[model samples]
Target: MKWVRSKICGITRIEDGLCAAHMGADAIGLVFYEKSPRYVGLDQARSIVQAMPAFVSIVGLFVNAQAAQIKQTFDYVGLDLIQYHGDETASFCEALALPYIRALRMQPDVDIAQVAKTYVNARGILLDSYVPGLPGGTGEVFNWSLIPSLDKPLILAGGLSSTNIAQAVAQVQPWAVDVSGGVEQAKGIKSAEKITDFMQALRANR
Candidate 1:
């Protein structure tokens, strides 16, 4: 069995970021959206990134941000990847000239395959649960059966935790899995124990 890559998102503190990296997480996300409680300031984000060991990817999460904002953050933090969690067009994403992952909120009517095709240049397509008037961190689980097999890598997100991750991996077999609120001690604060358990469960499944 292949190892299921893991990214611990919504990191707001340097301690949490280092904890995730120490626990073997492939990536740690820094939220740049002001509305999100997990949002990190540019200075904080840079500090967290600087604290990380080599080989740990630093991902910047944005929600409906302008190009200038993204560019400003990128120039400062030097994120390994960008995760767009808004209505960004493929051209808009491509214009940044940086590797990015498009987040697709799964509503019943959503055509994921078509969305994936439209963002063909994306490094991966992140499938997250949809909630009315919310961008992400909803902690709601969607129907995994809605996912279709495609050549592009699938990153399963939304409502993932140590309790359900094994079942989720067994069902979806995604290229990667992203978790935020699920392993959190509070909004934006991660628990090292939770992260360790989550990784243990994933390894057990493999």
Candidate 2:
């Protein structure tokens, strides 16, 4: 099957959320960690999720947050999925009993297939660049060639732009693709033009 998926993370405003949905995003990620520049408060996250059109999934992103904190955010925003970017254990992730995606920091010499197997119950695997001091949205791409035969759904991320997404799709053929800094006017701010361009490019590839 043809792989076609897109994610817009770090939404700070309702309009940005709307743009992502209107532009045909499969998922919209909301950051709950205060340390993240793109973090949105409970109220802001709720409003944004509510404003989003139907069929667009709401994904809550956390970086090394506790279960209590994750539950609190979920209760407030009612996210459909969880994206764990930090060193969250399998027990911690399964405790939520909700669908989730685990982010893998792609590094040279790492056994990519073996790493994915550890999160066997995950809804999908998110492959991102291993940038020091950056949780995600670093606008960096790992070598696409390093994907070592995936069995579960794979969501390709990091440094993807409209210009190169087709190349990414052609090569990795992931179940989905995610972009944040690549489609932003600035950190936490999305660009309508960029969103449209990205979607158009995505369609062109298909």
Best by lDDT: 1
Q: Write the per-residue lDDT of candidate 2 for residues 84-147, one digit (tens) a residue.
A: 9988877878877778899988977789788778776899999999988887877888898878
lDDT of each: 0.92, 0.88
What is the TM-score of each predicted model, taking all chains together?
Answer: 0.98, 0.96
Q: What RMSD, rounded to one decimal, does every model reach?
A: 0.8, 1.2
Look at candidate 2 and tell me the lDDT of residue 193. Answer: 94
Pairs of residues at least 3 apart in sequence or in different chains that clash in candidate 1 = none
Per-residue accuracy of model 1 over 1-206 as CA lDDT, tens digit each: 77899999999988898888988899999999999999899998999999999999989999989999998898899798999999999889998888899998997777788877888689999999999899999999999988887668999999999999999999999999999998899999999899899988988987
Number of clashes in every candidate structure?
0, 0
How many Å off is the CA of 188 in candidate 2? Answer: 0.6
Q: Which parts of model 1 have CA positions greater than 4 angstroms off?
A: none
lDDT at position 131, candidate 1? 95
